[model samples]
Each structure stands twice: as structure tokens, then as C-alpha cells.
Target: MTLTSIPIALTIAGSDSGGGAGIQADLRTFAFHRVHGASAITCVTAQNTLGVSRVDALPSAAVAAQIQAVVQDIGVQAAKTGMLLNQEIIATVSEQVAACKIVNLVVDPVMVSRTGAQLIDDSAIAVLRSHLIPQAAILTPNRYEAQLLSGLEILTLEDMQAASEKIFELGAKSVLVKGGGMSGELRGVDVWFDGNACETLTTQVVNTPHTHGTGCTLSAAIAANLALGKDLRSAVHLAKSYVTTALKYSLAIGKGQGPVGHFFPLLLSDS
Candidate 1:
């Protein structure tokens, strides 16, 4: 098989020492899609499947330098931002993204956890909303983050749809309100809005307690697909499928919640 040069996808996010989420998950997802992964780590966390214990953010200048080095040499086709820790990093990332002219940018608003815990401060979130999010090609937020962004409580499918549209007004080209944190029939269903259309995307719900890294994996998969030249909608659809499949084979590692099987194909082949 004659293969062309591999497409490069950049992930501007934090680092998880446990190898469950953040840049680790992003790189895994990119590699799964046969895309080269470049990274600009904004923070580092000492955590495992249990929870985060210590968190330290890198300097905004270092983050900007990393992005500059990657874009200048490797050249990213698509990029995604995960846990940008604070306002300064967020501002720097937004500026660098614009400077590098990264058109295919996916913003995973990692503001809140699945249990409704706020991860970042309000001021940081404000900067993310006003600066970085506006430049996003697609904004992916969870239920709580969606509520925060849209300033509306999301209880039902209609609420999700409404929130998607509301968040779209914040200047994102598109919005996807993830239903991973929802309950009942809406669980694992996502609402997508692109100013023109509103759609609900669903996949087989893989029941598992070990679903860490899901959000990162999903956004990373979308970037990977985009780097591979897929349209936005197609990239999202394929990324959802990939995440659902990975969840089916989620690893039961560590003591608490584990990560999805990013290399499930390899696991199946070995079995």
C-alpha cells in the first residue's frame, strides 16, 4: 500500500501523569486515526483513576512557545484545546492559534466535571468564553459546562437543543452539548448546532464505570478526523462512533475509574 505523508493534529491541553486523559488521551486518539500528534501542554496533574491530587500549570510563555514550535515546523492541520488552566494560558493559546491561523480548532470546554464540580475559576471561564471559545470551529461542552456557557439549565433534550443554540451565539462556528453527564434516555446522546441546523447524535450506550478520558478522547478524535480531511459533521459522527466503541472495551485499571480503551482494536486482535 502506497501511503501519503501523515497528517498532523495538535493538542493544546494539560498532562495527566496516570496516562488516562489530557494530552495522553489526545495523542492516543490521534494515533488511532493514523494522524501524527503534536502537543502544547498547559498544565500537569498528578492523578490516577481515583482523582487528582496535585496540579501545576506551566507558564503561559512556555505554552505559547510550544505551540509556536509545533506550528512553525510540523504544521498542524487541526487542533483541540483541553484543560487550559487559567486566563493567561487561555489568552496566550487564543493569540497563538490566531497567529498560527489554525482554522480547524476544537474547543472542549473542560470547566466542570461529570459530578457538577467546577474545575476552573469564574474569571478563567470568562476569558475562555470571551476569547478562546469565539475562535473555535467547534465547541464541545458537557452538561454542566453547557449550562454555564448557555446560562440555562439543561434538563431535557429540548433544553440541550436550546443550550446548543444559545452557546452558538457566543461566536463558535458550531456547538456540541455532550450528554455524557445526563441521565435516563438522554445519556450518551449529543446535541449539535451549527447556526443552520440542530441535530441530536446518538450511539449505543456502553454501560461502564470506567469512562475516564472520554471527553478528551472525543474532542481529540474529532480533531484527528478533521486533520484527515473530513468535513465537520462527518468528523463528529465518526468521532462519536470511535468513542462509543472504545467505551465498550474500557479498561478496568487502577483502583477507581479507568480510561476507555483507546487502542481497542489492538486489544481485540491480541485476544
Candidate 2:
């Protein structure tokens, strides 16, 4: 197959030593979808299923160099950003992405952890809003992140709709406000908006504590689908399905919140 015929997706994010999230999860998701995955790691985390012990961020120039290297040679059909850490890295990544002119950009604004704790400060959020979000073809932010970006508290589906609109107003071509962390019926329901249409994407709630890396996995799957030539709406639908199915096969490893099974299909076939 020629180079153009092969799907390629890039992830600009952090590295999780635990192998459950960040670049690890993103690459795994890309591979499962048969897309060639490349990465520019912004930070290295000493983390596990239990919690993060430490994070060491790379210099802004280093991060930009990685992106430049990948885009100059291998090329990226679609790309996603996760765990950008701080203002300098986010700004640098945003600048590099624009310089590369990557159209299918999925911005997973990873500001909050799965445990509902804030992972980034207000300054980083501001930098993301000003630099990165406007360039996104799709912005995937979880409930707390949506709340932070939109300045609207999300408690109901109506609130999610409001948050989606609010985030869309920030200039993303589209926005997906994830409600997986919400309470009651709102759980597992994601809100999508493109300034013209508003849609709700949902899946059956897989009740398990082993949901580490879900947000990363979902956005990466969406980027992979985009690399495969799917439209934004269809990509979100397929990515949602993939994440839900993976959650059903979530691993219970390391005594805490394990990762969604990215290779669940292969495991099922082997079984």
C-alpha cells in the first residue's frame, strides 16, 4: 500500500508509566483501529492505577521539536492532544499544530483526573482556551472540564447542552461535553454540538471502577476514525461505541482504577 493509503494518526500528550493512559492509551487505541500512531510526549508521569506519584514536564522546545519531527517526515492525518500540563507546553503545541496545519485535530482538554481532582491550574486553562481550542476540529472535555471551560455548572442534560454550546462558542469547530462522570441518568451520555446541530451520544453505563484512561481512549479513537476518513459525527459515534465496549472488558489490575481494555476484541477472539 502507498503512504497515502495507510491511515496515520498522531497524539501530542504526556506519558503514563502505568501504560493505561496518555500516550500509551492513545497509541493502543490507534493500533486497535489499524491506524499508524505517532506521539510527542509533553510530560512523563510516574503514575499507576492507584494515583499519580510525580510528573516531569519536558521543555517547550523539546515538545515542539517532536511534533516538527513527526509532521515533517511520517506526516499526520489526524491528531489529538492530552495532558498538556501547563501554559508553555499548550501554547507551543498549539503553535506547532497550526504550523503543521493539521485539520483533523481532536483536543481532549485533560484538565481533570478521573477522580474529579483538578490536574491543571486556571492559567493553563486560559492558555488552552486562547491558543488550542480554536484550532480544534473537535474538543472533547469531560464534565468537570466542560464546567471549567464553559463557566457553567453541569447538573442536568440541559446543563450539558449549555456547556457544549458555551465551549463551541470558544471557537472549536465542534465540541463534545462528556457526561460519563455525571450522576444519575446523565452518566454515560455525551453532548455534541457543532454550532448548527446539537446531538446527544450515549452508551450503556458499564458500572466498574476500572475506568482509567477513558477520556484519553475516547478522543484517540475519534482521531483514529478521522484518520480513516470518517466524518466528525460518525467518528464520535464509532469512538463512543469503541470506548463503551472497551469499558465492558475493563481490566482490574494494580489494585485501583485500571484501564479500559483497548484490545478487547482481540482478547475475545482468542478466548
Query: Against the true structure, what is each candidate's TM-score?
Result: 0.98, 0.97
**Clashes per candidate (backbone, < 3 Å):** 0, 0
The CA lDDT of each predicted structure is 0.96, 0.93
Top candidate, metric TM-score: 1
lDDT of 2: 0.93
TM-score of 1: 0.98
RMSD per model, one decimal: 1.2, 1.3
How far is 155's C-alpha from truth in model 2 (Å)? 0.5
Q: Residues 110-132, candidate 2, lDDT per residue (tens digit)?
A: 99864579988889988999999
Best candidate, lDDT-wise? 1
Off by over 4 Å in 2: 1-4
